[model samples]
Target chain A: MRDDEEMGRITLAQVAQKAGVSISTVSKVLNGRQDVAPPTRIKVERLLETHAYRRTARSSREAPLIEIVFHELDSIWALELIRGVENVAKANQASVVLTESGTRHSPDPDWIEGVLQRRPIGVVLVFSALPQAVKQQLRARSIPFVIIDPAGDPDPDVPSVGSANWTGGLAATRHLIELGHRRIGIITGPEDMLCSLARLDGYRSAMSMAGLETAPELIRFGDFHVEGGYDRAMEMLSLPERPTAVFAGSDLQALGVLEAARVNGLRVPHDLSVVGYDDVQVARWSSPALTTVHQPLRQMAEEAAQMLLRLRTEEPSSTRLELATSLVVRKSTAPPRAD
Target chain B: MRDDEEMGRITLAQVAQKAGVSISTVSKVLNGRQDVAPPTRIKVERLLETHAYRRTARSSREAPLIEIVFHELDSIWALELIRGVENVAKANQASVVLTESGTRHSPDPDWIEGVLQRRPIGVVLVFSALPQAVKQQLRARSIPFVIIDPAGDPDPDVPSVGSANWTGGLAATRHLIELGHRRIGIITGPEDMLCSLARLDGYRSAMSMAGLETAPELIRFGDFHVEGGYDRAMEMLSLPERPTAVFAGSDLQALGVLEAARVNGLRVPHDLSVVGYDDVQVARWSSPALTTVHQPLRQMAEEAAQMLLRLRTEEPSSTRLELATSLVVRKSTAPPRAD
Candidate 1:
């Protein structure tokens, strides 16, 4: 085979003549264009395998290519995750395609169908909630995929990779509690995301553990954005019983909180305390540097990519890997002042 | 032809028979796998084309995928650029493959070559200065590419999209001059990058315009990183004839300069006026908001993608597009205190 390492380019007519079929029938079967009958398709596939034709560099092959799709492109966190996927794919000599899913309210079914029809190796969905119909379609095709930070239902069988977001949330809340701040406010990400739910759960659990009463009025929903965080913080501060400490679901949100505090003439630590998540680069640079929960983003992304590659090569493993999270004690977190 | 689109598939034997060549010769010519006589190769190609036999997607139709290669994944600026590229790609219905072009000092050429062989639709080079051999290889294959912020000798023919970095530098320097700063210091990115040169040009242009002699000791080289900026600022501030205004090439570097100012008991604007570039999100959030040069990053990226797509479609056009840069006035810049 190495002698003719690249020499086996056979034409469809030769195969068709040998199989006693019209060139059109053979072409239809070989191209996998839907017009062909199943029997004809199978026959052509067998001939293809036996003859060992070389594929063009530009064409999609019988073997699928895995695609990793993300919702946001601006965040360093997303890029790190992508690096992880790339590392794994490189090791396996497999190519991974990346695309942005956009911020549309509904996932485009036509787009999903077109991608799947190309017979990708598998899909590593980044920050998308799979619709039931899409899931059903994938299931029918028996195409393997892994979801990262799915916004909706979590299928028990589908593999997923994420940080210990719940623990991260709990750690952030506990740090505030330990600072003797009873009036703590929370600014959270979109309610639809699983990470947001987990973070909320962690905050609740931490509050419960500290024997603190939950104040529904102290919590506000932000879209995990800087502006959202600022607006939410302003709302919290205007309350008659304001929170002395605030926990933001993301570092961007925390910065927003800081701005809100500044505009209100409140000094950090002396007037307010804050904690954030993801520990992105800006966390350490901002004034009164954000106290954040560090998610092992790079590690998690690498592991997810490796897991997807493994699933492609071996039988699907029944194991799920959850990376750890840690609290970075920065200036944003401090003891409450004696008012 | 539209109605009989399914009839385009034909076999190697038919092509070989029509071209009056052996099946092996036809295979070699089609696959470009082996050395074939030029006449025979051309004959086989014409025969295959005339018969309307389309290459199967499974057969090496060199995959039309394009790759976006970055030099460093950890840099926040790079991440933002990636986001811009992602947004544009999504709109164009194109897939982008991401890869790290390895480290800054010692890029892996072999890794890049292997990727090129995979036959992507095209490539968008981000942040890395590609090696000469790699550029030559791409040229040999006639692969269309677009580069962003290339450091090394970029191919003269490849389309490039970049911000007006030189003008940005001049604006920062001139802003300081307008505010009555006679002694000004500058922090710059890697010396090898064109941006570094452009920024230097801007600084000199502004200083000459202000009738201030370009002092040899006033300029420092930094890696366009926070730590580098901090270290350089500290050195410049401790001088006997310290500068009252410092212009940094990047927002992260500006933050570093601010930190150094704080440690040295110098107040921003009041004691030391600072101007930075790339009005990244952090510039506005910092305690004393940084006045910097704003690069229309989103537009630049979208334009870059459009350029690559045009090239991929074989549309010849200009090799470079220079986007505008504007100065964003903020608290970090102000008039120097008069003794």
Candidate 2:
């Protein structure tokens, strides 16, 4: 499928002809003009919402603008992605326009309508679940989209960029195990997120390899934010036989666990050990420095941008690109104290 | 100046007339269509780049998008501002479109052109120096823009939102003074930044009020970032007779000072006291937490958004808004120990 035909183009003339109205009436309805009759307006409005109207004919003079959609925009994690995308955009002479869905995992119903109106050359979605309906709408308009760290199991046909989350999770747990830790706990991201499930599976794989039963009580689902980590860590720490080491799904969550420990008077490494994912700057800035899995977030974003650019230029490329993750040893993890 | 006239709407016909070509020839040039004479194409393209062609008649059918431009998108500091703007935007049924200047303090020269092409209802600039030419262009297009924490001395005519940095700086320095530290070192933001200068002035005022001579060698200009704090603190700590306390320009800077102390094997509060500005979350997560000034970044952002919205409605309002900052005493400060 070529880029421009993704959302099968809907022309105003066609819409007007189908609605039995003049082009001016259709235009008025589109412009939200008050002069259109209510019934004609409703008919035109529904068509606009349900279909994409291509404006390329009159918009030939505008520069290529790329639209990046985020499930939410409140994260330091986004800074890396923005940097990578902006780097690519500048080199290509394209300007980026950012939109937030406001939801954590999906966009509002009319997001496609707004996106199509702008006629962006390409789109990048971060931590999102692209519903089939939206996907169909995008495909119909020929607007190629690439997902970065998609939140759920993405459709096989979709293009995406991600980190080796399972490997990262495995390495994190294995490091703790090598440090002579057992009874390890894991804080994973939202249950529906594929990366979260992959990380948890890796943890379970590590535990199974060590001949330890996977204890349900030691596993907690988190939102990959500080508060989520804090709340879950608080619960696990209250258990009669709490784990001596914890593997957090993300660095932010890891910081939360550290705070929970502090509140409970447990010194890191001295009384407990902790590991986190993402290895964001905060992980290094943590007092003890955090031992975390570096997800190459910026690299992933660059790759996503490159992939989208290739799609725009009609170059052949792989649909999915999963970058490697590596373990960064700082000071947050150590052997558990003698019992 | 009314919003929408900032770019002074131009049309394809106008470009064609100016280029001495047929309207079709200009339209082809705008669309990147081949077959036009090279010289004629160049003339038409130049006109298009320098002019604003109103797409509002066709774009009015699109949903409202408000543009938010940031000098750089590199820090978690932006999250608070994003949350605040997003909250208000949602309540008012408006969606935000974000852009970054890439330059640390100034927007790209062509930024306003792209923004006007998009026809956003309003714009909000964060830590930016809006050039006079751009301001005139925006005003002519009738586009309203409000600055949030302007990066430099904003033009008097521009509406802006800022924190009471002078007061915040005074409180930070005064707190250290009350803790019985006579020799105090200070770090401020970039040399050209208005906020940075105001903070340094505040520090000087506090020292003068305390009857302590402000030593030139003890002051350093910083960029309100971690690395800046680290390098400056390292130098201050190496002085033969170093000050007993340091006032960091920002929270990230304060963390850098902490790191510096760690490198020199100096225990915080016990050997050196520190105070920071901008009470971001990192301030609370630092080992001893951080004694810092709480700048109302989110509130300032909300206020900026409200101010822009008012401009979009052509309502009269104050041109400058300076919100108060307060001292947040945490664990990073203490009385100097007896030598």
Per-candidate fnat, comma-separated? 0.40, 0.36
lDDT, candidate 1, B1-339, per-residue tens: 564455554688988888888999876654544377867866776666555454433223233466677767666656666667767766655566667656663335545444534555567776445565455445434455677752323446657777787788899999999998999999988887778878888999999987899888889888887888899999999999999999988888998998788678787778999998888778877767789999877677677777777765464454777788999999898898988
Q: Score the docking of each candidate (DockQ).
A: 0.27, 0.33
Candidate 2 residue-wise lDDT at B118: 62
A51-83 per-residue lDDT for model 1 (tens digits): 654333224322235677766666546766777
The lDDT for every candidate, in the order shown, is: 0.73, 0.78
Q: Pick the candidate with the highest DockQ.
A: 2
Looking at candidate 1 chain B, the ten consecutive residues that score lowest on lDDT are: B54-63
